[model samples]
Target chain A: MTKNILLSAKGLSKSFGGIKAVNNATIELKSGSITGLIGPNGAGKTTLFNLLANFYTPDRGEVIFASKPIHQLPTHKIARQGMVRTFQVARVLSRLSVLENMLLAPQKQTGENIIKVWLDRKTIKKEEKLNREKAMSILESVGLDSKAKDYAGALSGGQRKLLEIARTLMSDPKLILLDEPAAGVNPTLINQICDHIVNWNKAGISFLIIEHNMDVIMSLCDRIWVLAEGSNLADGTPEEIQNNPHVLEAYLGQ
Target chain B: MLNFIINLSNNSGYIVSLTILTSVFAIFALGLNLQWGFSGLINFGHIAFMTIGAYTTVMLSLSGVPLIVAVIIGAGLAALLGFFIGISTLRLREDYLAIVTIGVSELVRLVANNEEWLTRGVQGVRRYQIPFVDWEPGILGKVIAIALLTGIAIFAQWQLLRGIKNQFKEYRSVQNKSYQPTKPIVCIIWGAIATIVILFIYINGIISLYNYHYQAGLMVLALLILALVYSGLEILVRSPWGRVIKAIREDEEIARALGKNVFFYKLQAFMLGGAIAGVAGSFYAWQLNAVYPTSFEPLQTFNAWIIVVVGGAGNNPGTILGAIIFWTYDAVTRFLLPQLGIDNARLSALRIMVIGLILMILVMWRPQGILGKKEELTLGK
Candidate 1:
């Protein structure tokens, strides 16, 4: 009873217009675990992420994160409560410098306060330096600190994705719902990103990566769930999921 | 040479007056720069703020409130109006908001003209008090002017020394200029504004020192406005915050996710910009020695919108430059074009028609205006 469930979504159902996008979807993610969700195109994988992230609240179901019901909360509120989500297409604040993009992530930012900035000069500088250092380390870990001053818009697609990860870390997030981290990234960088995720998971950050690449999911996910037509099709280990007849028939279509 | 000296001396008054007056409006333009330029907030009713400032200042002063207090009251009232309008309409789709603001501004003008007891209606408020005329102008006036100038200089220096944001750069309304270019034309505009201020200080010094008469001050005020516009734009463009404003303009949802309270920031921009408009209106009242609702018409707000758009939406310096360019054309056209046998009243209509045509062309040929970044204009994907 005291197993410490990090996230639990039960009987979640949602529809866009008249079409059911997610129905009867249920999942339990344990604290400090790496979970992967995979489904083919139109399998409602991204929509499920959107629902959990509060981009669209489920028409029916309860979502509990860290034991708090988060169904009615806004996406930003969810983010503030140590749960951040990334977009499938990559959402970068394109006009800002890479440093600015990183600086924006840390929740309850101290720099935006007009009074604090004017009154507490020494303290602000110290905190700013520390945050900058953390952001630099994250960027450097992701191989992006060299371009910290560059405009985020000018970066390549893969680099932007990496920057998003670096940005998410600034919040010291408890959970990250990555839509498709390896979607358009190079094969070489794909492994690097996966390795980082595995390492971060080892350090106690939970992640639910929605990946289409079977190999990456097999290598990274502790457990995998497959969805087809807004319904749960299969759930098991990498080897078990690969040979699930229902998953092969409906999702993989193999 | 004697005639030349006399002409220069006499003409200096009008030139200084115009420059200073222009600067005042430039300040107003900077306010608009903050709202529309920085945050992509379209405040089509900007002139209403000016009207509120002018009327409030004049009415309060005429009612026996201290001059400085009245000025503060006037600006405060204008800012209040801005806050209300921003709160109500900022949530609407931008195009709808533009239409609503234009209508609200018109309503304000109509109410001002009709409020006979309070505003004097068509008669307008007159014989208002002028601020800072404690002595006769000429040689002695220079000392007073110099003293005030030194005080301001010392204050600015002290504040900067203490590391407080000098001139409230953070509070100043910004315009979007991200990725367009590093050099904000506002710097040049400020230089132009400064050159005018120096000219006024020079002439107002020997010609009429310590005077600080309303009109002379008004003239200098305009140049001051111009300088504020110039510097405000430059400082905003170069700042990290200015980049954030442009990001909102480019993509609101993105800014929102990045921990920017997009709605609140936009609201702040609107109120600040509106307050600046109030300052412009106050100066206008000072220049004419009067205030009324008719002076702050919807057309005036529309004209500013045109100025911003024609000059360039994301360019604050462009707005100042556009205001001058447009006003000069109006002055010249109203004066010179009529000599070619065109009716004077029709010239006003003609000017508006030309503005409409220019906006059309700009939207068609280059929707981003003369100096705007295309990305800034794109809104979002």
Candidate 2:
């Protein structure tokens, strides 16, 4: 496929002692594309995601994000470069309210000088107003507008998922890697989440989603990459992947 | 009727003195409360900050610097100590921090005791300049000076509380979680505290200025204010930052993942709290009319912790309440213990024994103390 390269991981291999968790796995995430990574448990799909996001230093790999080599960068530094990831289990700042949860995500706020915040009350009040307006609008986009007053912990499982998505959006991400976005979500909420992914894709934010739902995997992903036992099984269109005998065998424990 | 009136008036001064002294300790407790109650920074060496405040004021005063400058120096030293303590420990985990802190406070006491040149060795610094003493003219002057100090302190506290409230309001979550800020409720409470502080100062000033008996009345009024000061401290910890501390207490790693920079916030809170503890120490110095190295012992810091845990670990109001109840019982016991079956030396030991037993019982049965949330009490389970 002819595409602008957004992130390319070459010769990625990592091991714990004698165990090769992710061995010589390489993948390319092209710009403006929704990609699917599917595999059974222990397939190193999440591990690969971790390595790609710079959470773990790969034993050997080169991660090029936004055309810069980011393998040695810290996780937050990687996130600041517009490549962010969401964990499988939703982690929200439980103390802050839902709105606060969203606001804290966009740590790029420039107006929050502690001295200026305390001393110059007027500037703080004005900044606060503007920040609130922006926060509310973003909350509206994620269907969490009404829950702005709610503590983050009080949100339901699906809402927390939406909150995680909202949090990533607050970072104004160019690319997102979701590790099991629809794992515990109800079907209806899962559809809402899928719709959001599709909408974000339309708005030019690319995603690499690890989804267990076969229907979700087949319908949305522009291209699919299947992994088996820490190795790439196949990479193709969803239809081509579904028809591939190798993918069938991998699923059937061959 | 005249005799009774005279008796009431004498007792009222003692009451006032008690209030002022209590206020000083209450202020110390409040600072400690903010550290323990809001941010969960285990500041075991709280009185070290207090010692800094006391020694600074006394040393500066003895050196012939103006009293205002000395007070400022004292406050500055306290804040400096706070900054140092905060930087050293706020990064590490809680228990390790606590152990180090307990050790650090004792080291401060040891330094204060041994350093004869600085703290006059074990004897401490005396003949320290008192605020508004030269201004203690007629009844009105004394009254005015006391009122001015009280008013200024209450006002500064009012402003400080306002800033804290604004910080709380920035990310406030719950309804009953009322921050002790410039809210109408807080205003009314401050108003009441101001009234009491003013009344104590005004009344004491009148008698002392007229009768030419000043020093003792000041001590009496200082002790009476123990409740108000700590209660105010309790209120701040119930604010949003307080909740953040509790969140940290519950699961700090989660707080970190949410981009809260749990370490930094904890440090800021720790320093602010230490500064407050310093203020308390200074205030105690003021109450005592002289500061000695022996006064800022580790026992004072640990005593505040005992007050916090015995009252309730995470509950602010409970600790304040604990302070008043404990101090009053302490005062009564100090007087009554000597009268009862115990010798004078053993009487001191009894207070320690009683404090230990109370702490032990509270830990064994009601680990969360009186007002704390159950989760605030940590067990390995």
Give me the candidate number with maximum lDDT: 1
Score each candidate by Cα lDDT: 0.72, 0.70
lDDT of 2 by residue, B288-343 (tens): 77667777777788778777776676555556556655677777887788777888
Q: Score the docking of each candidate (DockQ).
A: 0.33, 0.26
- Model 1 TM-score on chain A: 0.95
* Tens-digit per-residue lDDT, B296-328, candidate 1: 766677677777776687677567667766666
Candidate 2 Cα outliers beyond 4 Å, as residue runs: A1-6, A10-20, A23-27, A49-62, A68-74, A77-79, A110-112, A133-150, A226-234, A243-251, B1-8, B65-91, B137-262, B289-293, B307-326, B332-381
Q: Give, for candidate 2 chain B, the lowest lDDT window spanning 10 residues.
A: B173-182
The positional error of residue B322 in candidate 2, measured at the CA in angstroms, is 5.2
Task: Evaluate model 2 with DockQ and give the value.
Answer: 0.26
Worst 10 residues of 1 chain B by lDDT: B162-171
